[model samples]
Target: MFSYTGGVVLFAAVLHASWNAMLHGNRDRFLSMTWMSIAIGVVSACVVLYLPLPPKAAWPYIVASGLVHIVYNVSLVRSYRRGDLAQAYPIARGSSPMLVTLGAAIFAHEAIGPLHALGIALISGGIMALALQGGRVSRAGALAALTTGVTIAIYTVIDGIGVRLSDGEALTYTAWMFMFYWLMPVIFVAKRGAPALWSPLTETPMAVGSSLAGGLVSIAAYGIVIWAMQAGAMGAVSALRETSVVFAALIGRVFLQEPVSAKRWLACVVVAAGAVCLGL
Candidate 1:
């Protein structure tokens, strides 16, 4: 299961990067993200109908996760708006694992070994380096990306507990989480002229297709991470999952035409080393 978990999460990293890249490229990120949420909502609602409902004890965590997800989505949109994909993606993805590791050790009572501690340090330092290396990012963008990372850690810890409490039924917990969580964004967009807000998603074929693709991939990536948490330490799972930053940097450089300096490449290598240490 350990090896399988690593493989699954690495695959998820690809999907996570792919969807984020798509979101970063969208001219109207709000509309793109909104439509993506709507698509995921539709799919998750269907999945929830067949899966067993999460236990009552898990409800609070689920609700908490949903609220944190709202902050994460908002921060992510703002981060992308203010910064390039390579800059924002690493800062956001890199910051979460260490936070999750410390949170797990403190709240979850998960013990961290010397190697794990080293891994967390390397990962966090490397990610922050990517963000702070050059004056390539705006102050607002850097703040947003950092905020996004903190939110990711918050929700990850919440969902880790929520899934464990759901009678080992991670899928059911995830389906319900997605079903309810997306409502936050939908409500936000609807308030700003509902018709106008939704037109890009509803009226344009290309936008609709991208939303569907991004939504499905995003759901699959996170769903796999939630599942992996069931069989691994939340911190380790999170660190492994965050290898997405490497893929995101590559995607940004190749597809998005973002600059990828030697410093950025070195940072990605450091993140990989950290992930390997966590797995050890």
Candidate 2:
């Protein structure tokens, strides 16, 4: 079980990074994101038919998280518009752990130690460094990515609380959240009249397949992490999952032809170190 947990965590990390890469590589990020959300909605629709609803106690958190996810998705798209994947991905991914830690301390009365403080400082410093890269990362990109991270931290806390109140049916809660989370993007696209919305899926088999793959991978990544948390050490699982920062950087450089400087590599190391500290 431990070995399986580790493998699952690794695969989840890769999938998480891959989906982000897909979003980054897409020519029309907003459209791609809309399709991805619709894909999630389609899958969730099937699951919610048989799964029990989330407990009433979890509804508020689920709703709040759904709303925050919309902000996250929008910010992510905007960040990718103005920044290279290598730069934006690390800053966004790196920022979340410290913010989540601080949020826990404030909202859940969690204790903070020297290590936690150090981790927060390191993450903040690394993100600041990325933001201050002068011509490398645009201000719009930095702000958008940082905003994405903040939204991620908020939804993560909400999900953590809501899942506990799920009456041993965390999957059901997740399904419902996915369903609700997709609605905003779908509505937005509808309002603007997306004439080419279904063209990619209907006219191009590869597009359909890629969209399905992205959605499945996205769901699988989160689902696997949740399973790993149940079967293994949560801290270890979390730290391992954050290795996606490294993976994202490599993917951007190798696949997307994005320029990753030595300084950015060092920044990634600092970010990963901070994540490790948070886990510890």
Candidate 3:
């Protein structure tokens, strides 16, 4: 069994995968991404009002994280545009734990035990396998996913540091970060023009509705992750949280009808094994 924090993060991983897999249902990946961002931002804004502000020490990180998250979302939309959810999502997400581990070590000064190292190595190899899946996901998708992974690593460390420095205001910090980070539909509105962005709302109300649900799930998932980070090493929390890749592989295969090769299944197993090692 996982430790308390590990269990919490594991639950978060499930939620994370659920929402991401749902993301494939939309016709426009950009629209889905934008709508989900808006939905999460709206919810976060409401919650952030009641929550106390994070300490000044955490504000810089909050701002920096917000900037980075924008990049992450944009890259994610691009990756999905060019790839299968299983291939792109795993490559995007599975690569993050190792990056976070390295970032946490250098920036947070966290020590890596042998088990942790082994776990990261396994996860990294699994990600490589997923990325190498032939002709299923485009080169552009892989590149975009790699970019997303980098942003994920950067923000994971930033948020880990931010939330831990919140003086027990982890909830407040997380809420504020999400609220500030997204401001949701604003960027898309600017890009597509307000008319273009909102007009789709009427046509694809289902996508909008599902995206809203996903937004709620996304916030809840990351909220748990930020809370868990307070009690675990940033690297460990990140590694464990990334077990979403396994769930993602399944969701992509079953619901979305994305092909999952035996090789991909083996890779998912390897990733899960790595996650277990990280938990241990």
Candidate 4:
């Protein structure tokens, strides 16, 4: 189970980075995100229908996860609109493992070794260094991204607990959580305006294609991580999956034409090394 979970975590890290890159490629972040949400909803709903229901105890966490994910998506979209993905994605994702580690300590009474603490510090420092590049970090954008990180940590812990409570139906819970997660965007559209809702439908084919890719990769990334947690320690799974930062930095440099100084590249290496330490 540990070996299988490790493989899943590695695969999830790649897919997670791919979807983030797709999101970064879009010009209209909100519209692209809406389409991605719809795609995820459809896929998750199909999975939910085919799989058995999760145990009753898992529903509370599932619902809480849905609410937390809504905040994460909103903050992530806003952060991307305000900052470059290289800056935002690393800070956003990098903060999560540490937050999850702290949450585990408080809620689950889980203790971390000195090595894990060192890894967390390295990861956090690397992200901060990356975010501080260009001599001007948008505080609002950074805060929004950091908030997204916190929400992700919340949901990660919640879902981790949910999977444990589930009677061998982690996949089913994951599918349903995603199915209900669509409600956030749906409610946002309904409250904001119909124009915001309908605009994505008229987007160009290329934009729609990118959105679809983002949606598919997002599902694959998260689905694999959730499955992995069922078979391994949640902290290790979370830490390993966050290796997405390395890919995100590379994508930003290559595709977004963002300036990647030698300093940032070194920071990225530090983050990757930290993730390896956490995994070990």
lDDT of 1 at 67: 77
lDDT for predicted candidate 4 compared with the true structure: 0.80
Worst 10 residues of 1 by lDDT: 180-189
Error of 3 at 121 (Å): 1.6
lDDT tens digits by residue: candidate 1, 15-59: 999999989988877777777888788898889889877899999
lDDT of 3 by residue, 1-280 (tens): 2677778888999999999887876778777888788888888789887887789999998888888888888888888888878778878887788889888889988887898889878877786687686756666777888898899999999998898889989888887888764654778877888887788778878888898888889889999988887767787787777778888878887898877789888888888888888877
Could you estimate the TM-score for every candidate? 0.95, 0.83, 0.95, 0.92
RMSD after Cα superposition, model 3:
1.6
Give stretches of model 3 more than 4 Å off: 135-137
Q: For candidate 4, lDDT tens digit of each residue in 1-280? A: 2365666777798889888888878987877777788889989988888888888999999999888887788788888987888888877887888788778778766777887777677877787788777766687988888888888899998888788788878778888888865775676678677777666567587787788778988988998888777755566677778877877787877888878889888998887777767766
Clash pairs for candidate 2: none
Residue-by-residue lDDT tens digits, candidate 2, 1-280 = 2255666676888999998888888777777777778788888889999987778998998788878888888888888888877778767876776666666557655555687566556656664564455467776777888888888778766666567677768688788888875674566567666666766766765655665677777877876665454333333444456567667878888999977677877876785676567556
The regions of model 4 sitting more than 4 angstroms off are 1-4
How many backbone clashes does every candidate have? 0, 0, 0, 0
What order do you get sorting by TM-score, best first? Answer: 3, 1, 4, 2
**Could you tell me how far off, in angstroms, the CA of residue 266 lies in candidate 1 after the best superposition?**
1.3
> Candidate 4, residue 189: CA error in Å?
2.8
Off by over 4 Å in 1: 201-203
* Superposition error at 124 for model 2 (Å): 5.5
What lDDT, from 0 to 1, does candidate 3 have? 0.82
